[model samples]
Structure formats: C-alpha cells, structure tokens
Target: MADQDPPKKPSSGLRPIERLNSEERLSRLTPATATATHHEYCSKFARDFLDAHFYYCSSKFVVARGGKVKALDEAFREAESWFSKALDWIAATEKIEIPLFYESREVQVSHSFAGRLLRLLMQYDRIFAETLYSLNCGSITADSRETTTVIAAKRIKSIQQLCIPDTDKFAPDGTLLNSSRSQTHGHA
Candidate 1:
C-alpha cells in the first residue's frame, strides 16, 4: 500500500473565539507602540472580538454559534476602520513562552491572566453593546443582539466565579503601557 503522507493534522485547532482571544492577548503583550502606526493588524483584536460578539448576537444562531447580520456586519466593518484609526492615536511569540491564555498555562485557573483578560473583554462587550444600542435607538431586540447579551453575561458569570476573589484588586491595565489613572485622566 502506498504511504500517502499520514493524513496531516492541523498545526493548531484553535476555535474562532480562541483565535480572536489570541489576537487580543498578543495585542496586550506590547508595552507601547507609538500609536502602532495605524494598521489593520492593530485593529485585529477589536475587529475579531467584536466580530465574535456579532456572531453571537445574530438571531440566526447556527452551527457553532450564529449567523451574521447585515446591519451589524457593516456597522462592525466601519467600527473596525474607526478602531484602526483610533490606534493611530494610541496603541507575541508562540513556543518561546508567551502567556497566551493562562499566564504560561501553569497558573491556577482562578489566578491565571486569562481571568483578568476576560474582565477586559467583558468591558469591551459592554461598551460595544451600549454604543450600538444607543445608535440604533435604544432597541436591543432579540433578533439582533439577544444571544450575545445573554451568553456573555452567563460566560462572564462563570468566569467571574473563579475571578471574583483575585479580581478584587488585580486589574490588567489593558493598554499594556500600564498608564496610571492620572495619565489617562490628564488627557480628559
């Protein structure tokens, strides 16, 4: 029998959600980037994260999660463009030991960097939801944003159960620059 190169396997079987997550994690690893020079790579995380949320929001909910909505699709596309531009204003390795999900994947789940990251993700979800909701007339109907709204709450709740204790005083400083509140407030 001919040896047909033993059916190749995927190098990585990361899910869409996981990919989105990985991008966000990668984005955070950098301390500062002189505004990232404004690029698609910069918006990668925001685009991916919100895209996943959009998929979750679709009432067409299918296969793995849900289908995409036209209005939201455009909205998100434009949103990413705006986000990329925003990156112009402000702004990882695989095997060499970079904390992808769980801070070296060795820490306890409750203490992992992931919980802190998820907290930031939850914050993003909220801002996006609120922004979209307001722009669309205070209407978060079941057909558009129901699942995302519902699922994220549940997901956050589950993750928070492990996070609550440590989360009390452990904030990630998502910008990675570790900007102090005064620095952020100074601009405002």
Candidate 2:
C-alpha cells in the first residue's frame, strides 16, 4: 500500500496557557468587572456541583455509602474547592490596590467584603438544592409530554388505518341494497 499521510491530530481551539497569556486575557479589568467575573465563575462552579449531586443520586452504586445525602455532601465539598480556587484567583490575579488613609473607612470596606463572602457561602446549599429540584422537574415534564405526543400520534394513525364499509349500493336507511327488480317490474 502507498504510504498514507499520517493521521491529522484534532485541533483544539486554543491551549489554555496560550489563551491565558494572550493580549485579550492580559488586559486589565475595572474592579467592578473583575468582581463580577469572580462571582460568575463561582456561580458556574455551584451549578456543576449541583449537577454532580443529581448524577450521584441517580447512579447505581455498589456501596452503602452512596446515599443521596452522602453524595450531596461529597459534591458540595468538591464545589467548595472550586470556589476556593476562585477566591485565590481574585487575590492573586485581580488586585484592587488602594492606599488607605482613614482607618475607619478601611475597616468598613474589609467588613463588607467579608460579609459578602460569608453570605455567598451560606446561600450555596439552598441554591444547589433548588437548581437540582428544578432541573429534575423540567426533565420529568419533558418526558411526559413526549410520551403523550407519541401515544396520540399512534392512536391517530390507527384510526386512519381502519377500513370503513363501502356504502354506495345501500339504501338511505342502511337496512337494504337498492332493488333493481322494483324499477324493472314497475316499468314493465
């Protein structure tokens, strides 16, 4: 056989490090934008974590330790790790450097930031549970709707396929055929 060209490697759109080091990525964000990005990343982590919880609950497990509550706890901890990474990214990459002149103002700012972080952590459990429940409900509704549509389509097809009796030779009352003999005798 003629030597075939070596199989081409599939191209991934961009290498992670290249994307990170690119000019667009290196461009500085306003503090507000940076804060929003941080929250967005953490929110994605929260959603993925909730999805994992649902998966675990649905999966067939060999061990007794794989109960829903246990699975939920495991998923929560994994998501928290991702959230921690986001926090670290904010600290290391998105610094909002400002010289503090007034001690009281600085104290207030610090307290507010801390409070925000704590509030987010507190909300995680409720948010995760709500997301899982909503997704489950949506899937169930979609499945039921699909089943109903298929059943209705089948019923309609069956009805259409039924053979109706031909009625061209029948009388209006449907008890007897139209008599050619009556017409012939009356005329004769």
Candidate 3:
C-alpha cells in the first residue's frame, strides 16, 4: 500500500495571544474617520439583527420555553440599545442640526459627536432599503384597499364553489320532492 500523506493542519500563527492584543489596541484608538466607521457598523448590525429576529419570532419561537423567549427578548433589547447609541454617535460627529417645531416655534437641536457618528450609520439602512426595492428582491405586498377587495372576492368565489346542493330533496322546479335522480345528482 502507498504511504498516505499526513493531513495538513490549519495554521493559527504561533503567537495568537499577542496578535489578539495588538488588534484590540488598534480598535480602541479612535480613528480620524471614526464617526463614519461607527455609523456603518451600527447600521449593519441593526439591519441584520432585525431580519434575524423577525424570522426567529415568526417561525422559530412557536414552541420555545420561557427561558428561550426571555433570552431572545434580552438580545433584541440589546440590539436596540446598540442601534440607538450608534445613531447618537453619528449625530454628534456630523453636527447635523435638527429643527424641532413645537406650537409654531422653531427650536434648533444640536447633536453631540456621538449622535453625528450614529447618523452616518443610518445612511446604510436607507441605502439597503432602496437597493432591495430597486432589485425587486423579496415578496413585497401592497397595502391597498383594492388588493384587499380582490382577495375577499376570490375567497367568496371559492366558498360558493365549495357549497353542495341537496339534490335528493329538491326538484329543478323548486318543489320539495324525493327522486332517484335527485339523490344521484346531490341537489336536495
């Protein structure tokens, strides 16, 4: 028999601990473009989290225990907090002014550095939605009265088609008469 070659082991460079520490320190340093980066990260995370959560709650949680439900709820809450903080960070960095209108009085609301950074993240979400629509990516239902009416009409037609007449008891002339033909035809 031929000697089989040893299976190649996947390499994790010798000093992983040192590499990890360096990477951690690099992430901690606030970059000159930190606001843009933070916004992008937060927005992407929020979008992914929302999509996953929707799928899980809609189909995966039907028979979940209380503990599982609680865990998922906590995770969702955390995601929301992250999203809010990202938005705050973006707003703060950009200094985008939001004018508040109350009782016909215009009030200028100033954003902090964090808020500006977070707002940049939101741009990704807007772009995501636009891309999905432009690509005709998923099932998009119309929320219109006309669509509802059409659906209702079809349902009514289906129900009418399903109804069976008692042919055994009623004659074509509308008389309550028992006949062998009526029994066979199911028109009573």
Best-fitting candidate, scored by TM-score: 3
Q: Across residues 12-37, which tens digit of lDDT does each residue of candidate 1 receive?
A: 88645553223344334432421221
TM-score list, all predictions: 0.21, 0.20, 0.24
lDDT (CA) per prediction: 0.32, 0.31, 0.33
Predicted candidate 2 versus true structure: per-residue lDDT over 1-188, tens digit per residue: 47888888779775545432222331232222221112221333334422332112212111113232243234345445554553343233322233322111111111222233323433442333333333344532444334433443333222112212223433343333434787867864
Superposed model 1: Cα runs more than 4 Å off: 1-115, 118-141, 163-188
Instruction: Compose the digit string of candidate 3's lDDT tens values, residues 106-160.
Output: 1111212223222322433533333334234333233422343243333322222
Q: Give the higher-TM-score candidate: 1 or 3.
A: 3
Q: What overall lDDT, based on C-alpha atoms, would model 1 receive against the true structure?
A: 0.32
For candidate 1, what's the RMSD? 21.8
Whole-model alpha-carbon lDDT for candidate 3:
0.33
Off by over 4 Å in 2: 1-66, 97-188
* Root-mean-square deviation (CA) per prediction: 21.8, 28.8, 26.5
